[model samples]
Target: WLKPFWLKGTSSSQRPGNLYSRPLPPAAMKTLHQEESIKVPKGIKVTIKAKHVEVTGKHGTLKRDFRHLPIELYLANSGHEVRAKMYFAKSKQLSMLRSVCS
Candidate 1:
């Protein structure tokens, strides 16, 4: 269930004389484009596949399949960061990756 809109005003904070009351100007608006990266532990090993990613750490190996996505996954920064790069991601693809990564 969701909270009612009327309750939002009571729960949210409104500071006095706040300069941020107005929204950003059109010229100040910026596009957000980010690449997701997961850190690779010192003793971990990673294998990047076209449809899946395999990671082997001190604990064990973890594999995840991303066959349906339109993004590319790889290792970066001397294999320390597992980066997910997307050329043009649909909403489904973005949400799927976000859930899995988070």
Candidate 2:
């Protein structure tokens, strides 16, 4: 019987391990922190508590719930700015943070 070329001298690592049928690479990954902020105008009130943000201004009060997201939201610069932050962020998380911040 004849044998295929790839089957003759291949190791386990050379074999494809996913649905795409492509070999997986052995590499290291890093995690870091991500932060984004926006300034709050003088007349607007910004509050952060219990994974929620409440903004009060001439247009009335608006509140948003962020409990579902993995990032942290806080007030900084003496309540002059609002920031969204995430620690030990992976690539997937970084992308999400960027979208949310921008």
What is the Å distance of residue 43 in model 2 from its true position?
Answer: 0.6
lDDT of 1 by residue, 34-96 (tens): 477898878889888786888888788889888877666788898888887664555555676
Per-prediction RMSD in angstroms?
13.0, 4.7
Off by over 4 Å in 1: 1-33, 90-93
Give candidate 2's TM-score: 0.68
Please provide TM-scores, in order, for all candidate models, with all chains considered together: 0.57, 0.68
lDDT of 1: 0.70
Per-residue lDDT tens digits of candidate 2, residues 1-102? 555776667555555563446745865464667788889999999898988888999999988887888898889999999898888877877787777655
Worst 10 residues of 1 by lDDT: 9-18
Query: What TM-score should be assigned to candidate 1?
Result: 0.57
Assess the local accuracy of residue 48 in candidate 2 as a C-alpha lDDT between 0 and 100.
89
Runs of candidate 2 with Cα error greater than 4 angstroms are 1-22, 26-30
